[model samples]
Target chain A: MTRSVPVRVHRDLARAITAIENGYASFGDTLATLPARENGKASFVVGVTGPPGAGKSTLVDRLIEKFRAGGETVAVIAVDPSSPFTHGAVLGDRVRMQRHSGDTGVFIRSMASRESGGGLAPTTHDATALAAHAGFDVILVETVGVGQVELEIVAVADVVAVVTVPALGDSVQTIKAGLTEIADLFVVNMADRPGASRTALDLKHMVRESGRDVAVLQTIASEGTGIDDVMVALTAARASESSNAGRAVRFEVVRNIRDAAVRRALAVLDAPRGRSVLERLRAGELTRLEAREELLVYALAEVINAD
Target chain B: MPIKVLVAKPGLDGHDRGAKIVARALRDAGMEVVYTGLHQTPEMIVTAAVQEDVDVIGVSILSGAHMTVFPRIMKLLEERGVDDICVIGGGVIQENDVPKLKVLGVREIFDADATTQNLIDGIERVVAEFGRARKRTGAATPAS
Candidate 1:
């Protein structure tokens, strides 16, 4: 690739975001400069995720309105699934919040979940950091919300709200197995619809049975009902910082190291040895466990040696 | 980086089937499409483009107001000094109006009958051209 003249970005918010997006050489230095807590307030990150068509966007739209009403500046990072072939994604989350379009108090950015496991874009943490550094009081990271495996939001978000709808098969098992453990709040959105209460009740029962104190809230996001309650719950979650601070810190640190290694590991996995291991497994010459062990050893050695 | 296109339906066009179709097509073609939901004005579209930092602004107008809408959008882009962003139009346009719309700074006007492939190809070409121009001028590349 030919090198072009460097373009200067004036605003720190834009500069940090562009640097992370482009993976510029200065990204690490730029990230290091951002203050963890700005303006005496540790910026709160709230993650809203659930299966697709669960009204996550609408829920986020309402949450933004509520946050803004409380005199808080809000920044939204909507993570959408990327196309496997071209690594592109349709970022339509802003369409749901058109009323907030020209409002200077709110900033909405749509991000593609580019090659990152757990339904988050690799740049999500950097973007949230920028939003915090720019003095946004509340930063909402909305996940791709594809399925169970997209639980990476918990690693970055201070509060993780899983928004689920009625009629998703075996809701109890799905929630109990995956979403239950990580969710700071479980929301049964579109609560006005049929069977909404049933879903909420089931979730409430599951929460009780699991021995965790996570809140289960019901919401009709389009109508803007139950939004205030959700906000109140999130405020409480944010206030109880000491409880989750250690976990959050560990998550951030481990992810910071793992993210860089994962990118390189992926590159190695696409190389010749990785292909041969996969072919062996497919041909029944090697068991899945054996192939995984071998590939892990090779990739781990490569990463460790590089360091 | 994927190309970002803002699909705006300007005016009181309640019919958004075309806009939705085109937005999905652009997404399927490996480009990000920001659909400014229906009933947008020229000002709203331009403001969206500026905020979203899109490379292409595609206006879907079926309210027979292309002549008024396209010029106003172009004027807003000029006023903001964001003339580098490519403009395209579609929906309920008369055959002869294409020339006038083009004169008003619309790079290409696709008719309602234009296939999704045609829209995709036209957008890719325009976005590529705009990118080259931006690079030559050293403008900060639009966010993908």
Candidate 2:
């Protein structure tokens, strides 16, 4: 690990970081070079997901403001849809979160979808690590949790808060749909609306039916209402499950082991013969099962030769 | 090895699934991605870029900070003598701002609707262009 990398490497690194910053898919060698921060040093990973126009972004802004007010630094990762055709991310979702426009304590990243799929994105994990290393106390992840995507924040966050509003459309035919049980806390924002109380009542009824121990709270992020209680409930949840954060310590260990194995395999298998085998697989001369078996044998033989 | 790229989030724009997916896509495409995490000031992104010596710098921003932040990166790299680096940006950029970004030395500007293939193509195109320039000018191609 040299302090001064070659200038071309610098150029490549710059282009890669700029790619992610601008919502494009960056190279993976770029991600691998991100030095891993020490384990168990993770911040409080909290997720906020809800329907479109449910004021999820506003609520996230409120939470981040509060945390920073308490002298806590915050990191926010907002995930938006990518252009399937162009494979780039048009991350307009981050515009709604202008409340913390200039605050130094808040680090917001708008992720554009272009390259990959499924779960909280890997760059999000890297951002979490970077924030932890920078000594942020909390990381707030907000996803476009609409359209049947079951909780992208759940895997990434220690606590997941599902934001829901009253009259979430299509209630005429069905009762249970959208961000329901996956929410650790059910927030009924826009509490200023007329049916707000009724919506809370209905939500309570639904929660009772679902048999999940979710805390339901009321909030009007526009007017700054009931956020304290939401925080209290969230703090209570974290206080109850300090062990979940502890699990990240174990997660990092597994990641390290996987990395070691992959590197070992790559180092041994980087030969002319090994590459020809891959070409055979790509050409469909070998089935994937056969290819895997062959690679295992090849990898072991290569390792022995290198030794 | 596929070309290495680093994606960074500077200022305050907390939205990352797209960056992660792109990183994964590049990985699947046989390239390596090093994500610098979020809240990167221009200095951190540039420092990491120089240290990692990546083939590309992919910056993702949606916070309207692009106008102020992206240019700052260009300036920083210029000061650090790494202006040959290919810079690209994608996110909720206005249709009008594309030219300004290019004028600022950003090689490509993809909007929110771009697919992974477009990004991979952009990286290759930009990298190849730089490779040609390096060859013509007798500058070294980036060493692995």
Query: Which has the greatest TM-score?
Result: 1
- Each prediction's total of clashing residue pairs, residues at least 3 apart in sequence or on different chains, is 0, 73
Model 1 TM-score on chain A = 0.84
Worst 10 residues of 2 chain B by lDDT: B135-144
What's the DockQ of model 2?
A: 0.10
CAPRI quality of model 2: incorrect
Q: Pick the candidate with the highest DockQ.
A: 1
Provide all candidates' interface root-mean-square deviations: 5.9, 11.4
Off by over 4 Å in 2: A1-41, A98-101, A114-119, A169-178, A242-307, B1-144
lDDT of 1 at A163: 92
Model 2, residue A162: distance off in Å is 0.5
CA error at residue A264 for candidate 2, angstroms? 20
TM-score computed on alpha carbons, candidate 1? 0.84
Tens-place lDDT per residue, model 2, B1-144, is: 246577777778766777778777776665546575567788777765554456678988888878998899999889777755678898889988889999999989889899999988888889888733453243222223
Could you give candidate 1's per-residue lDDT for residues A1-307 as a string of tens digits? 2111111111335445645765652555665544443457777899999988899999999998888878888878888888888766777887898887656677777777877877788888878877776678888999986677666777778889999887565554645576667788989888888888788878888888878888989888999899889988999998885355666787777777787667666777799998899899999999999997888888788888889
